[model samples]
Every structure is written in structure tokens, then in C-alpha cells.
Target: MDDETSSHIDDTDRRTLVNAQGAVQVVRTTSESVDTRLQQLLDRANQQETEMTDVADAVSELSATIEEIAASAEQVENRSQTAAARAEEGDEAARQATERMDNIHGQMSDVRTELQSLLDRIDEIESALSGITRIAEQTNMLALNASIEAARADNSDGFAVVADEIEALAAESQEYADEIDAVLSDLRSAADSTDSELDAALVEVEQSSDEVERALDKLGAVADAIEETATDVTAVSEATDEQARVSQSVMDRCTTAAERATEMTTTVDAIDQFRAEQTAMLEEIDDALTEATPALSVTDIDRIPTGLDPLDEATDGGLLLGGQSVIQHDSPVVDVVATLCASALSAGYAVSVTPPEAMSRQDLSEGLASHGSSLSDALATDRLFVLDMFDEWTSERNIFDMRASSLADVNRETATRRDKPLLIVGNIAGEIALLGEEQARQARYENDSTVFNPADTVCNVVDERTVDESFGAFYAGAADQVLELTGDGPNRELTLRSSPTGSAPPRPLPATSTPVSPRGD
Candidate 1:
């Protein structure tokens, strides 16, 4: 379900604040139980890095694709324009052909008119021939009748010869008339056939012109379709570019988010482990305090050794089982005392952190972590408890306020002292809490009251960031052993301001084996 949701969000470009917060909370919750969540964050960061690379590659490919598309669209546009131009030219040609056809039809019409005129002339000729024939027929008939009368009169007159000549002339006129009629009939038939053929040619030319016009229209439509396709391709290219830009933004944001989550995971792991340790110590201490009595013997002293081998040897083997030491820490490095603290714990010392000058909760957790101790582990084992006077927001910090209502409450005496070593470091968050003279004086006074116990080691850290002369002077005066810490890097200078209760100050302390945090600017 979560994977699907994540995919959908990535697809939709939803980066709302609420969702980010929810995701962070989930990561934190996971880290609470195990380091798996941190690993997951790491994996996610790695995946995002890979994804960003892929996106870059994809963007490059998309750019190339877009260029290709643009080229194709341009080509298509050019082709469509060419096609449309040809269509226009074809329309012009078709129009010219139509005009030519019209002109031919008109010419044919004129030819028909000339043919009709010729026909009219033929008709006149035929009419004249008809009149001559009729006249000839009448003359022939008269000549015939005259010849018969002569023959009947039994006279050999020359009139019979005149009548026979008239009859022959009549026969020649009829022959001419018949020839003129035959010529007129043939002319009429030829004129009618030529006119019909001309009409058919005109119809065919007109049909061809119409077909050309239709073809031009279809060509125009095809050209328009190609133009429209080009436009759509161009639009798709632009949209792809926009999508690529959006993808780039998402990758950038994811990279940043992954980096931050990874850092948080690291810090959280440290705190959680340390918190667990402290919890365990706290539970043990609580049980001891409730059931155990305040008592100590010489045997208990051997169990209260500070973790540092040299420091322990210099201080006559180690701290007394119920002794208190004051450390004037010149640097902000938390590990300055880590060796001693862890060493003391190994010797069965239960430690409690109530620092007076931690800048924040991370400051406390980071400090303990540098000393080879997990704050969570200490808390879980009931050997440590943070009085919330520190950063009220440190995750390892118990949310409930640990700030004492009255200065005296801060000075509350150790409830019980058993055979086990009890080491309490007072005021882990006092740097910000005690800035002024009054606050410093009161905090110092409260701490002074709590310095002594039957069988425990009270450790006080005087961070120069907040501890003024009055604060340090009070803690040093109250403490049995005093140590001064100063350094920036690996070569830290440790000096014993005050040694054990007996014997001369031992040889100067050697260099620390464990690394101390680099001094801040």
C-alpha cells in the first residue's frame, strides 16, 4: 500500500508539507525500534541518487526525441505546403481547361451555324431545280402532243423535230434536279454527325474538369490533415519538455530530502542506543534506591574506579566508592570525560546525567556518545536518567519536565548508597539555563549541597561556556578531587588541579588514548 501511494505521489508531483511530516514521523518510529529504518533511509537515498542519474539520461534522450519530432513536424509542414501549392496549381490548370472547353463548344456552335447556312443555300438550289423540272415536264408534254397531232395529220413538217428536242431538254432538267437533291441530303447527314460528335467531346471535357476540381479538394484535405498532425506533434514535444523539467525538480528535492533524512537517522541511532543504556541504568538505580540502604566498606572502594587507567592509578588506584570529583572542562568536547565515565561504569558505577551546560539535547546525547557509551543503552539498563532540565526537546530526554521547582529540589541528596558505584554528573543542560550571576550562584549552591554521598561518585562538569568563576570555584571547593581538561584535537592537555586525599601529586597525566571531539569555532 505504501509503495503504491509513494508511486502515485511521485507521478502526481505532490510534495505537501503534511505528507513530508508524516514520512519523517514514520522514519523516526522505525528508528525507535531498530536501525533498519535508518538503513531504509540510506537505501532510499542511494535509490534516489540512481534515479536522478536515470532522469538525467532520460532527459537527454527526451531532448533528442523532441528535436527529432520537431524536425519531423517541420518536414511534414513543408510537404503539406508543397502539396497545397500543387493543388492550387492543379485548380488553376483545371479552370483553364474548362475555359478552353467552353471556347471549343462555342466554336463548334459557330460551325453548326455555317452548316445551317449551307443547308439553306442547298434548299434554294433544290427549289430552283424543282421549278425548272416542272417547266420542262410541261414543255415535253406539249411537244409530245404536238408530235402526235402532226403524225395524225400525215404531213412531214419540221415541228415534230422541235417537239422531240423539247422532250430531251425536259429529261436533262429532271436529271439535274435529282442530282442536287442527292448532294443536299449528304451535306445534311454530315453536318448532323459532326455536331453530335462535338457535343460529346464537350461533355467529356467538362467531366474531366469536374474530376480535377474534386481531386484538388481532396488533396487540400490531405494537406490540412498533415498540417494538423504536425501541430499535434509539436504540442507533444513541448509537453514532454515541460514534463522533463518537472522531473528534474522532483529529483533535486528528493536528493535533498534523502540527505537530511540520512543525517537525522545517524543522530537518532546514537541517541536511541544511548537512551536504552541510560534507561536500563535508571531502572537499576531506582530499584536500588528503593530497596537498598546507605552503606559502604573498604571493599566498595575498589569498585569505584574511573575508567581511565592512568587517572585511576594517579588517584591511588581509583576514586573512593563514595567520593565526588569536580572537572573543569575548558573545551566543549564531550568525550573529554568519556574514558573515565565508561571506566567507572565498568567497575559497577551507575551513572546519571544532569549536566548544567549542554547547549541542547543533541549536545548531551552527542557528548555521551563520544565517550563510547550509548545514551539509549544506559537509559534502558536503568543506569542513567536525565532530569529534563536539559533541552526539553532532546528525543532521549524524558518529555516530562525535570527542572526542579525550587533550587533546593535540585540539591536533593542521594536517596541511597549501595555497594554498587553511583556516579552522578550534575546539570547536563545548564549552559543555557544558568547565564546570569544569580542563576549561576543558585545552581552552584544546589550542586554543592548534592556533592557528597555514602557510596557514590559525584561528577561535575564545569563547561566554560556557562560556568563563570563563581560556578567553578564553588564546585572545585566542594569536590574531593579536581581535574582540569583543555584541548582542541587529539593532543589534549590534562592537568590535575587536586590529587587524592593522601600522597604527593603523581607524575603528570599522559595523553588521552580515545579521540576527543574537535573544538568548535
Candidate 2:
């Protein structure tokens, strides 16, 4: 009783002690709340840490990918630079080659001309020899007659000496005529061989010239592609750097939040301190999350590569910003067409195709698939647009279907020029002609007009056996140049019949076939 009374004291003292106990209860509740908040903050921090770890892993993976991309871009850039330099060199060399071929042709022509002149002189010499032979024959006959008369007149001794001298002279003249005839025959044979060899050499030089032009065109395209790829790689590197910086900033905030949580845990026993710390930590987390900035985006590239040296050359650096070309071949080069399209897309040029209506969709897809991944990606991204002519279209994915009912409408769009070249595949000229006389007339007008911009390059393919002679002549006259293909399979023969810009004769182009696979065999 005494101890309880002492502890309690008076009513006032008892009240004070009760108030103290209530205060203790309040402190305990506050402490519990503080602990709850701290645990909540800690849990949140832990979740954030897990997220940060995920982000770190993601960033690491992205960085590795970016590094590979950067490396590839660097390699591409370097190769492009080399290709550009090589193309320039090739262009110059081709120009020189053209000049040399011209010189050779002229020299051969001169040689032929000089040989003809020599033949003309030989004809004059032969005429002289013929007269000498006739004279010799007459002399021999006279000598024989004189010897017989001398024998008949019984004056054989003196006449025989004279006859013998005449006979000797005739024999000498006859031998000279025979030698002249033999010399003439040898000269004619040599001239014929020389003429044939000159013609062959001229043909070879012309062929070489065509090959050079094609190589230059291809190399130029490759250079353009490399430069564009390098640019993209550089942009990726910059983005990666920015991402790394942001990740570092996030980690710093995470560390700060973790330290705050630790302080809060330490002060869990002191609710007043805990409350202050929790408020500050929440603000820090909010600020850090809110303040994080996003990275910028990369821009699209331009001027792609055409894998084919000849095609690239004809198009003047892979169907680039400026320049136009037309091709008509005597073979089904669907693989070649697809390969070029793939090359262009890989190099960053937007492409659109108006496939032959005769071609089945499944076959077209299979043919395109023969090329590889770039074409698939191009279609997926809508970078490669296909204008379905007959409404029967098939593709790996759903694509934009441009249903132009009339050829004129298609022609109108075809004439509407863009920044990049459009590739018109299949029998383009033949198809246009088949669009009826009215449409053909319109196509003719479009072809002749200054406003014409169908494609930077137009390529038409037809089999050698089936290609119309008239069609070949039409394109030959209409196009800036003509490449006539013959044979089939891996070693098809391409002959450059004419180029308005060149003086060389028909040249045989190098045999090129689309690889079995797109990445190349």
C-alpha cells in the first residue's frame, strides 16, 4: 500500500503518472507507425533496387548490342569509304579504258584501211605480173617457132643459140609471175587474219569497258550505303552513351534512397526523427523518378547499294537521288531483281515494286525469299511497297495494297517523281504496250515528257527465245542504253549493244547470277 501510494503520490501525482503511461502508449503507436513507414519505404526501395538491377542488366545487354552495332557500323563505314575511293578510281579507270578502247578501234580501223591499201597496190603489181607472163608465153612460143624454122631452113647452129636465149628469158619471166601469185595469196591470208583479230580485240575492249562501267556504278552505290550505315552506327553510339549516363543517375538516386532508408531504420526507436526522414526519402524518390529524361530518336538513312555491278552502274550509283536508267534483258532474272531490291533496302533506300501480273504471288514470295532477311524486314517496315496489279497478292505479312484500276492512274503515280528511285521489274515496256493503244500512247507521251519520273531505274526481263525482236528494238531506241541478255542459268551472256554516251561497239558483259541465298553464296 505504501509503495503504491508513493508511486501514485497524491491524486495529482496519480494523474501525472497515468498521463505518463498514456504518453508511453502514444509513443509506442508512433513508433509502430514509424516502423511501418520505414518498412514500407524499405520495401519500396528494395523493389526499386530489383528494378534497378533489371535495368542494369537490360542496359548491359543493350550496351553490348550497341557495341556490336557500333562495330558493324564502323566496319561498314570503313568499307564504304574504301568502296567510294575504289569506285572513284574505277570510274577514272573506266573512262581511260573507254578512251583506250576508242583508240584501239581507231588504230584497228587504220590498220584495216592500210591493209586494204596494200592489197590495192598488190592488185596493181599482179596486173603487171600478168602482163609479163603473157609476154613470156609469147616469147617462148616465138622461140620454139624460130628454132623449128631454123631447122627447116637447115641454118640450125646460129638460130639455136638465139632460140636458147629466148627460151631462158621466157622461163625466168614465168618463174617471176608464179612467185608474185604466191606472195599475193600469202598477203591476202595474213590481212584476213589481222582483220579478224582486230575485230575480236575491239569486241573484247568494248566488253571490258562495259564491265568497268558496271563496277564503278556498283562501287559508288556501296560507298553511299557505307556512309549511311556509319552515320546510323554513330547515332546508336551516342544513344548508348546517353543511356549509360541516365542509368548512372538512376543508380545514384537508388543509393541515396537506400541511405535514407538506413537512417530511417536506425531511428525507428525515435519516431520524431523517423517521420522527418521518411518524408524526405519519399520526396527524393518522387523527384528522381520524375526528373529522369528520355533519349532522342535516330533518323532514317539515304542512297542504298545495288549489289549488281552492272545494274548499279547503269542506274548510276544504286538508283540514287538523281539519274535514270532502263534495262531490257532476254532472261527471267527474278533473282537478280530481288537481290538488287534487297541490296537497296539494306543500304537504306525505300523501294516499291510493281510485279509482273503474270507472276503468281506464291512464286514471287518464294523468289523474294531466295534473297534473304533484308527483304523480309523491308516488307515488315513498309519500306518495300508492292503495288498489286491483279488483286491477287500474297506476302509474309499484310502490306499496303495499291489497287489502281487503270494503267493511266498507275502511270500518273509512276510519273510523280520522288527523292529515291522506283524499280519497275518484269517486262515493263512490253506491259506498257499491252495496256492498249490508248494507254500505250499515254505511256509514250510520259516517256517523252520532261515531267517523266517513273523510276530512277527501270528493268525489264524477257527470255531470249521468246523476246520479240520489235520489242528489243523499241527499248533500244527509247532507252539511254540497252543490255541484251542471252543464254540462261549461272553463265548467261549479256551484250551491251548501245549506249548513247559511249562510242564503243557491242561488248559482252560479265556473267552474273543471283546467289541461291540473299546473303550471297
Candidate 3:
């Protein structure tokens, strides 16, 4: 408006107009700058809101993960608690078992010691019984000799009393011995049963120990798994922590889960230790049982003969002969007669049997063959003599006479021939007894050699069923050595009764030594 005042007045008005226009332009520029700055602030606030939303979403995911981890941690904590309880129970059970085993071992040790003592006592008892038996036998022999002397001196009352006392003592001793033997047998049976029971117990313990060992192995595996899980959980927790620095909420739950897994591993380890200890204890028990099985052999086998050497050692040293032996029979003595006849024939000695009718010749031959002697060799040796009394007798009286005469001839011939051993067998003991004592004594001698009296060689044979006081009297008076051959369990056993050298009264003749044949040679 002012161009120069029209020019001056006009100038003043123009200046005012120009100044107002400048102020207005300055206002418009300031307003535009403020509008641009406000628009920028709004855009930045929007970006900040988006970032806030993303953080919120991330926090939400972290919270969910933390909840899941919390649940897992709780489950792991429960499992660890359960495992801890189980481990405690296992430890308690193992401790109880160990205590029980200790008690069992103590009891077993005491039992073993007691058993050893009992075995020693039994051995002592057995030895005492044997000694008693020997004493009884000696007493019996003494009683028998005393009876003979009393009868000869006509002291009947003394003889009866002495005999009664001796018989009673012998019976008592035998009863005691039998009782001891029975007790020993029972002890042996008990020992065998105990051994069987111990073996079964050992087997059961071994199986239990194996099962416990397997359980321990499984627990160890579980512990290893838990450890691996804990390691993985720790790694996850660390990654979550780094993420939480960028975002914040997930690391805490991962750390808690790792701690729970570690706790579960500790419980498993405790259980494994308990099982391992139990297994070790069972192994020790098994070892102890295995060590205790060899000292029970007292009454299991028979006592072998004392004087005889081993069969292999005695191959060159044959059986010794020349003892007065009697073979008594109920019907006919088959085994004893055959054995003696075979032995004599094999020894290359002239052998004679008085009653050939009593035995089978074929049986004799076969028996000889069984004893390593050929039947042909025995027959060809011309050493076996058979006196057939049946052919020599015409009547019953003659039969008796013939038997008596033949026995006398056999005795006389055997006594006269020192080089030959005689095996005289008779079917009837009555026939031999019928001969007068003087005649019998004479018949028992060959020339000046007496072979059927105590001072020489004597033997008495009487049937067991018919053996009585009279038989005993005859046996006591006539024999130096009397043997009763009896059948017992697939064998023929000989029971010997003899007089001691200085105990009885002196005899009419001096002792005569019979010739003996060497073995194998």
C-alpha cells in the first residue's frame, strides 16, 4: 500500500502494511514447521506401539512356555520325590536283609562248630564201642574156657553163675554198640539233608542277587537319562535367558526344569547304590556256603581188613594157610566146602573129601574155574581125592561105620603126609561123634602127630540149629580153633572161637605146627 508517502503518508501506511505482511509470512512458516514435526512424532509413536505389541506377544509365548516348564518341573519334582522314597525303602530293605544275613551267618558258624564237635564225639564213641566189643569177645572166650574147666571139675553151681554173668555182660555190650551205630547212622542222614537244604538256599540267594543287580543297572540307566535331560534343560534355559534380554519371560522356567531333572538323577543314584550293596552281600553269602562241604565222612564206608596188603601188592604173596577152621552146615556146606577144595587143589596139595555124596563134582570144577584154576588142570593134577562112602556101605550100620573109618583114614593119611593139606567134609556130625573118645583121638593122629586136639590142631563143625550145650561142650573140649561158617548177604562169613595159649589147662601133647602152602607161587 505505501508507495512512498502518498509518498510520505502513503509511505507510513505502506510500511505498516509491509511489516504486517512479513509478520504474517513468519507465522505461516512457523505453523508449517510445527505441523511437519507433529506428523513425525505420530509416526515414531506408531512404530513404538508395534514394538510394544511384538514384545507383549513374545512375553505371552514366554509365559506359556514357563507354564509348560512349570508343569514339567512339577512332574519331575514329583518323580524325584517318588524316586527318593523308593530309594529310601530300598535302602531300608537292603539294611534289613543285611542284618538277617549277618544273623544267619552267625547261626551257621555256630552250627558248623557244633557239628564238628558232634562228629568228634561220635568218632570217640565208635572207637570205645569197638574196644568194648573186643573185650566182650575176650570175656566170652574166657567164660567158655571156665565152663569147660568147671564141668571137668564137677563144679556146676559156679559154672552156671559165671556163665550167666558173662552172657548178660556180652548182651549189654552188644546193645550199647548197636545203639551207637544207630545214632551214627541218623547223624549221617541229617548231615545229607542239611547239605541239600543249603544247596537250595544258595540257589535262591543267587537268583535274588541277580535280580537286584539288574534293577541296579536299570536305575543307573535312568540316572544317566535324567542327567542328559538336565543338561539339555540347562542349555535351553541359557538360550531363553539370552532371548529374555531381548524379550524377558522364558528363562526362569527352563532353569527350574533343569534343577528338577538333576534332583531325579540324585534319587536314582541312591537307589543304584542300595542295590549294588545288596548284590555284594549275597555274593559273600554264596562264597561262604561254597566253602563248607567236605568234612562229613565218618560212617560212610566200611573198615578194610588190617593185616592184608593191597591185592596188587599181594599178587606174588598168596594167602596164608594152616589155621584150624570148622564149617558147620544145616543141609550141606556148598560154598565153604567148594572154596576150600578149590584152594587145596589149586595149591597142588593132595585134597580128600570123606563124603563125596554131599557135593556135586561139576560144581566143584566150575567153582575152581571161577577162581583162576582150570577144571582140566584140577582134574589132571590127580590131587583131588573123593571118598565115596555110598559105594562102600551095604547097610545103615555099615554106612555109619564106613563114614567113620573113611574119616579116620583121611585124618591119619593127612597127618602122616606133612606135604599134603586135607579138606575133609562130612554129611553127618553124629557119625563122627559116635566113635569113642579114645578111638576118635587115635583117628585124629597120623603116627605120633595129633591134628584134632587143642595141643595139636582141632576143629568142630555143628549145625547151627542143632548146636546146643552138648555141642558147645564138645567144641570146648576138642577144638583149638572153632569156626562157624554162616551165610550172610551174598557171602560166607566165618566166626572164630579159640582158646588162649596159657589160659586153659595143659594138654597131653605138644602143639603141632601144620604145613602151609605159599600163595601165587
lDDT of 2 by residue, 1-521 (tens): 11121111113232233323323433444445566766676666556656655665666566666667656666766766676577667667766876786787788778878877887887898889889889999999999998888888875889888998999999988998898889887987887787788788778877876786777677667666766766766676677667656665665666566566556545543654656675566455434433442211112112234566654454334432222233455555555555666665554445566554444444445544544534456566655666564565753442334443454454444445334444444345335445643454355445434333422344444443444443333344333335555555555644555443342333334543343333220
What's the residue-level lDDT of 137 in candidate 3? 80
Q: How much is 322 displaced in model 2, in angstroms?
A: 99
Off by over 4 Å in 2: 1-46, 49-105, 141-167, 234-521
**TM-score of each predicted structure versus truth:** 0.40, 0.37, 0.34
Error of 2 at 369 (Å): 88
lDDT of 1 by residue, 198-230 (tens): 577667766765776676677667656766765
Native-to-model Cα distance after best TM-score fit, residue 9 in candidate 1, in Å: 58
The global C-alpha lDDT for each of the candidates, from Candidate 1 onward, is: 0.55, 0.54, 0.46
Candidate 3 lDDT, 310-355, residue by residue in tens: 2102211211122233445443344444555565555444454543
Stretches of model 1 off by over 4 angstroms after superposition: 1-43, 116-124, 146-165, 202-206, 209-213, 216-521
Candidate 2 residue 311 C-alpha distance from true site, Å: 99
- Candidate structures ordered by lDDT, highest first: 1, 2, 3
